[model samples]
Target: MAWNTLTCAALARNASRRLHHRALSTHPNPRPYTFHIGASWAGKPNEPHQRPKVPWPADGLIGSWRDRTLARPNRTTTSKDAGEDFFFIQEMRNQSILEGVSFGVADGVGGWVDSGVDPSLFSQALMYHSHRYSRNAWAGEPEIDPTLDYEEREQIEGWEMTPYECLDLAYGGVLREKFVQAGSSTACIISLNASSGLLRSANLGDSGFLIIRSSAVHYRQRAQTHFFNCPKQLTKLPANSGRRFSRACIDSPSEADVFETKLRDGDIVIAYTDGLSDNVFPSEMVTICSLVARAGGTEEEQVQAIADRIVEYARQCMKNKNRVSPFERDAARQGMFFRGGKPDDVTVVVAIVHETS
Candidate 1:
């Protein structure tokens, strides 16, 4: 993979033209802000949602969290008990130095189970490699650039990597991992620069993030898909696998849609897998955020509550077949009929931004 998009010199040139700065940079910031992150998750069947003991803070650039104790199906995606979604929230760094934060959600393609592949394996590995790459900006092991294309002295830690670049490197990492076998996943990634107040994002499929401000949904990315219920995804095929898998909505991280926006104080960023969107409407999320934004402890605590409410509400919506859901609405638009909410692995990451005191 040509990760040249984030080379040191190239990034420096781009930085000169952008409004945001890496939080770890020594440059003077005219306006400083901090980000507080919170997240929630639940597998299929709408069990009680779970979250980290506490929300993540603006303290460091390398803090990361993953869920392992939750019970999920061991194999087939058709299993009602399966949870094929995965997610991560980690501070992005440049050579161990705090720069920004990167977070994302990945939903494994359940159909892979038909080919004897575990659906969770691909989604989990994708998040793992992406988090590792964002934490240190190196694909594989600690300091070594697994690509081994460049000389040691000039290896790139990605001075200010873009969301797509991060996805690209992580995609490379998955290819390097020999045990992955075969699978595919839809991903949406975000990079927030605190000092510059800029949000850079890359989305490859149904999983996406939304920007909520002033008690309303401000900006939302439309999902990319080949057709109704078939989202764009990145896949790794086995050596023997042929064109049979090629017809799937296979995509490359390079093709991810990218966007940039300047953030403001008290903005809410919600990133989630399709499960949330499929069940809960955008208007509903804005109402949830507005109601929960206040009556909070600290910044992170507030967002955590918001995250919890959104996921729990989505689960509730899933169990109700009486009302029309986002998924059903979308299917109707495509001339396909569907019932209530979709039941799949749900993962969410929420962030609240505040100006420095």
Candidate 2:
């Protein structure tokens, strides 16, 4: 603040932001590849208002990006679960089958509860706006359907949106939400350009994704944190409560870790929150998914099976006092003696990459 400092990180971010807002290719194909995606989530048993157990979502639970329901607020569940953690899954289409996919997960900071804010207000609203923000994005040049109303066209000024901008826009959306007065959350979101096979991501905090290829981890995000237990998180604080929530870590989507990679057919991407990460290991994830890989079916069926198994594994481990979990191991590393699993909300999103012939 003293010198209006311009550090190397600042310069890098500025350059990346420009690349992110650049116009998409003039000629866009409606379908270059189609992905089969599915999701599974649950509230920790100790959490209040949670059902005895959350059954897996229906097999045909797929959705369209154009499906207006995605843009709506998540009233579908009570505040307890998502006030803990939340997730979204949607497929993008133009006129044909599958054009691309946009999906992510968010974990609300439980610390907000002490400040009288329903944690879901921030995480859920952030996600609602995140899902809404592709609509919540930068103006570009191309892709507005001629049939759209003048206002609709204006909202989506036709161009590709980078994950960084989406997170930035979504964060702003939360700030404007009068209802979300104050709170914080960790988010990990992805934009898969099916046509070009490019996958771009923005992850802040510990919630993140991993790519599995040929039964092994092709890619995985290392959890970003300020110290042993406090991960990087996006937050908005109430002025009156600033002294109270002073220790809360505040992050902007700009500080998010941006990653890009070329995805190959059959690669499986599992994006999840720390609930799963803290409970399971990468080698364990490969082993769990291998069950469905051996008993294969259509991508839709396999995707559902994979999501179910992963969630179930985490749930079971959470309740098994004798079983040492990843979070427990990490606790030991930090010289804290905690046992078994760390019970928290769990969310898992699975996608299978498929290239059309």
Candidate 3:
């Protein structure tokens, strides 16, 4: 049951059918507000690197915020060969200042192959198309007609597509042509409108997003691995679908799923690629975030500290394997193994919400 043997046609058929059903559901329009965003990226050991910068809105915020990415990393590496391919983009409506959205993405390296497609491309595509898609969806654009079903258009309720759908269409086309090697990614995006205060989110693969309130944590997870012969149900693309068309598909490519929630004052939203999650625990993440908020520094400094703690903690744990406290060792063995075992590409984006009086 190697990843090379999975069938892409069957997987695609299933995914497309699932998406057809999801599109039929009703989605709530969201309220919106202005907010600040900051992001950062650190490539895996010995690989190319790119850093995410603060994106500023094109126009003044009436009910929205914006930010843009800086540039790709200048330094290159060849060791473990794990580098981060990440992207982020923010946009505001052309006519309306009260409506806007933001998207963030990080592509995971395909197993051993270079997966011809750069990770940065995927993130950039998500950021670019998501804004476009959100604009269209909010404006009531028609979904891609799978079969040009004119009959259904009259009798059936059209599905409200998410930004992820636009991303899939755009990204899928690019990967089909450019990326010859097998690869996968975990992505998450958030769209908000100040007029309605509605927040929409979508995810795929393993990248994660977290909402932090005063005392609680709400996490949204996407993209589960389709390991060799594993039976867990995660979205996996069918085999032989991408450029190579020879490698087996593991997990079905996840759907362009969406979730809506309300935003309140004093809320903190954190989005990150697997590089950060794989090496750090959820509780530990919360602790680091709380400390950063209290200590009060630039977003970049806070982000660097969080990334450093993960790398340093993992490195230290690897060094003191035998000295683990009896109680802690057992838990560490089961849970922290991935974090301490090796260094992986790490990227984190932190946004702190301020209540406008």
Candidate 4:
């Protein structure tokens, strides 16, 4: 497949500019913010309803989070086929019990750009709906039964709706009439119930999330791919005209693996797309998280630094073609041979738990 060279040296330069220009806030309840790399939607924003902005700190043990994403190095944002990645974080209302914070990352498959549909829309739409469903599902849940034990509580807390249900809802948003081109994307979502100390996650593709404690990996989502360059995804149905589509199109929600874990104070959770995960190895990720965990600064500053450093590392991997990816290293460890890194959109979210056990 041929790839276009981006004019954005303009793009690359702009990314550098944004990173330096980011404002720093030291106040306890610094404002919450969101950002994206690659192309923005052409029409009205495909985002889920926007909520009123309020003074909120990006960190706290109960829930503090920050995120960032960047196009593959040397890629131009103006290209239709440039990084097609999107992410979101939904903050809970003051007294919500069922859902405290929700976050997600999605990678829009590049193949769909030829079909006249901007693949970013597919990803952004999925994340928008997933964000909405996460909150609504929690709001609609039955009141917790105080009689339940810890095991029962953990199970029941995440049982209101399956991950697949959230995927389907995101799919519906993608297929809405305003958007006509058929497309597909991979998504991973994580939601936290601060009061119960439960962190629930689900994913439908290579995009994944992880939990880190004491400079070690507490948990990391496994990548689900049919093979290289072919991640499992939620796809669009063909129109009645019976047009042909890629054989990879299964046209259904991919199975979403779910994980639930209890977070303790100072644990760091990270979610990222394949650009970072596929290029950097697990041990490398641990080192990056550990540095952030130990970094001296406000929690918000450290989290931002973590996102910046990881994306920078992924960019370095892309530029140094001879660098063997973690994937290749694993294959070599297993007595098979593989090599090199992948150049693609990289997105990451860093969240720090504030409450002590």
| lDDT of all predictions | 0.70, 0.68, 0.45, 0.58
lDDT of 2 by residue, 1-357 (tens): 111123212322222101011112344534455576766677766667322122222342212321233232221133324336777654444433344667889988777665566675567666766677554332222343669643354365333466776777778877776656787899998877666767888999999999999999999988989987788988988857747776778887888998989888888889999989999898888876776666545556566666766776787788877988999899899999989988887887888887653
**Model with the higher lDDT, candidate 2 or 4:** 2
In the range 27-76, model 3's lDDT, one tens digit per residue, is 24332344445444555553344422322224632102212243322112
Candidate 1 lDDT over residue span 253-299, tens digit each: 88799998988999989999999999989998887776664443555
- Those runs of model 1 whose alpha carbons end farther than 4 Å from true positions after fitting are 1-31, 46-82, 94-97, 137-158
**What's the residue-level lDDT of 249 in candidate 2?**
87
TM-scores for every predicted model: 0.78, 0.77, 0.59, 0.68
Global fold similarity of model 1 (TM-score): 0.78
After superposition of all CA atoms, the RMSD between model 1 and the true structure is: 12.1
Model 2 score (lDDT):
0.68
lDDT string for model 4 (1-357, tens) is 111123212222333322111112453443232211111211111222221133113353111321122232222223322246777666443333323566778888877755556676567667766665554554123354659642354344233544555566667766773443556888887766545557777787889988888888888888887766578888775576364663755645647787787777777778888777877777776776565445455554455556656666675675565888876775677687766865667777767666622
Off by more than 4 A, model 2: 1-30, 49-83, 93-98, 135-154
- Candidate 4: list runs displaced more than 4 Å: 1-82, 94-99, 135-164, 241-243, 327-339
Name the regions of candidate 3 deviating beyond 4 angstroms: 1-32, 46-68, 72-82, 94-98, 112-161, 173-183, 227-247, 250-257, 297-341
